[model samples]
Target: MWPIGRSFSSQNLFLCLVICQVVVCMLFVIYRNTQSLEHRLAILTSRWAAREDGFDFPEGPWNVTDSDVVRCSDLINGRFPSEAAINRTIDAIRETVIKDYEFIELTRDCTKFAWERGYYNKPITKEELDFPLAYTILMYRSVHQVEQLLRTIYRPQNIYCIHIDSKSPPLVHIGMERISRCFDNVFIASNLENVYWGTINIVKAERHCQKDLLNRTDVSNWKYLINLTGQEFPLKTNLEIVQILKEFKGQNDIRTLAQPVEEWTYYRHVLEGDTIRQTTLLKTEPPPDKVPVHKGPFFSALARQFVEFLQSDIADKWLEWFNDTKNADESFTQTLASYPNAPGGPGPIGSKAIISRDIVWSSERLRERRPCYGKFVRRVCVHSWRDLVRVSKSIRLFANKFHVEYDGLVLQCLEEAIHNKTHNPPMLTFHFIDDFSSSE
Candidate 1:
């Protein structure tokens, strides 16, 4: 130390040193590496400026951190909430929700809307672009929530097939249509359904979207198909998703090998319109061709080949049989994967546990009495602020069941978390950072 302090001389005198960190956030977080100062400044300015200069230099979509916008960034990024802060958040959320302050009106102009929302115009990476995705999004209500979900998952390379329940009001359809018009890659399925819980229409709605996605020649190169409801949101960034999915190579992400619930298939059950209980009963037929039926969430990430199989004569027979079964959506795709002559490429090889689609069924955790601060919808938890801290470390890619009416703070926090990670990347501290630096 003493010797070095006396001399500042070097042979070239041109060498310079810079500091950087390999900041890794939990589970599948990916941030762009080593940006130029001008580029960083452009990102900082994109919030209001939303200019083409920023969109030209692609890394990820520009996002406004909803937490900072709502004043909850500190409390959610691992800091314990003070009582006053909690009360303040509560008051702000109540005020905003009652007045509907957070909602943004969407228009049909793709250029203006995209610039206003700061969608990534180009592919972030060659890897992500080549592995385009197709989404079968089932959304019945809440246009704002659906828009946020679309913004989070949207990429020009992917195609989205949105199915709005035919039972919803005209405003819901109008709102969805407005949003859909703003993106060429997104569209409403021609065949929509009057979906009801535990009813045939539930499965019919999703099948319709798969059929639509497959028919689209524009985004036909899409390799994977992920299904989602308006309430579900992605936990990982697009870049990270591409990485994880590429690792999968070709295997589908779904759960199987579940014990038979005879009541589900043996009896016909129908849920009344907008009602929680089933009032109808009739004899149900056994699965066609004696195929092995498996139980899992209807929401899944599938391969294109499997979706093709779903449209064939063989799958039509199964669909016809399942029309009378209770909650057939939960079993339809899973059963098809286990079928003897099904796609064969998507399954019978992957793990039984569902790693891609994540959901916390509050009903299953009753023995431990884990606190579900969020309200339960059809036995699934609608995420609340308390869930934010816990989900930050979840290994799963996408999480299900978020209701803005339930508690938007958690959604805001999550959106901000992903936003900050996408634009302003890692910091060495355990806390969140509004700064980024790296090398690819």
Candidate 2:
């Protein structure tokens, strides 16, 4: 009887220990979860604060930045300062404009000259630093064609920060300088660095543009920012473009596009199918270390709010996911932007959401000719002038793939077609022809 009693007590003690351990684990988990939730909430608050005020400026959204004030000042001082003056006067009611925000619309050469003579090496911070303004940056290697488009097609109303790589020699800079002279709005960065292929140098160069813009927020009034390659040409006039953008105003839809998982897989298998084997592909598992996941470079845009989203903790988690993966730029942005449960939720899909445009190519065709330029252009350009006339009537924007030599005719024809009185406000006028057209 004694022996049996002792055994029962021992078993009870063992069960108690197990229960205690389980309870302790549960407590630890709860505490950790609470801590995590608090951290997330703090980050959300900071992001919201940053969004309301520009990044690094802690004031309310109503608090105006110095750079914004400068552009407004420049606009007020300009020939067409009515709108600019009104906007500036309204902003000045809140606070005086900072110096960095002042528009250096004098001339690209003059600005570059000033920069070379130690103008902006040290950024203006909020304290001793002026309210750093975001500069709007435009990057492209091929400028000759872009210059032609800017000169002949549509000149942007706002001054733009333009950079061409140093490899093109003094002639490119000279050409850009000439362009700058004609339009005070185009400022060229003279200190061009050699961009090494397949390295982060290109990315860093772009970031430099972003940093410059971020540092000097006064010159830029853009709530949404676009990163355009020199190859990218705008199909619409500035008035029409602004009109279309006005529709999306107030509604913050930060756009960051990514190839869908299926699309990513398609690229991966198409590139690696022969070596990867059918059986391995059929396994339906995550890619092994031996196989690289495929991703492509993107031409993307982001709203100011979306940029804040990138700075948030949510983006850190996203970075960790793609840190080791190749072609992470494509994967990270797309996945985070599309992830349903992500903070701030999924971003707008693409130009389709803004206005319908075709960019499709068959897998077989793409395989036969990787990155078909003419086909891409023809997707919108169509055959003959008649086809373009019919198609342009429906589509707001169109892009072409042919060399400038081949595609120049298409552009001229497009400009002429839109100029026709019958075209009504031009084909570009229909961009975002929704309920909001009357507002402009």
TM-score of 1: 0.75
lDDT of each: 0.66, 0.39
User: For model 2, what is the error of residue 145's alpha carbon versus the real structure, in angstroms, after optimal superposition?
Assistant: 1.1
Q: Over the full model, what C-alpha lDDT does candidate 1 score relative to the true structure? A: 0.66
TM-score of 2: 0.45
Candidate 1 lDDT over residue span 1-440, tens digit each: 12333346532232222111223332123333324332332222101222222211222322333342334344344443454565567567655542112222547466778877657642366667788998888888888778778888889999999999998877888877877887789999999898877777877888898888888988888888888888888876675566555545566776665845777776665555564343356554556777777777777778788888888887788888876677778888888888656654434233434546657776674423334567788778787876664464354568888987767777777776667555633221210112111100
Q: Candidate 1: how many backbone clashes?
A: 1
Q: Show where candidate 2 strays beyond 4 Å.
A: 1-142, 152-157, 181-184, 189-203, 250-297, 308-329, 335-387, 394-402, 416-440
- Indicate which candidate wins on lDDT: 1
Per-model TM-score on C-alpha atoms: 0.75, 0.45
Cα shift from native, residue 56, model 2 (Å) = 49
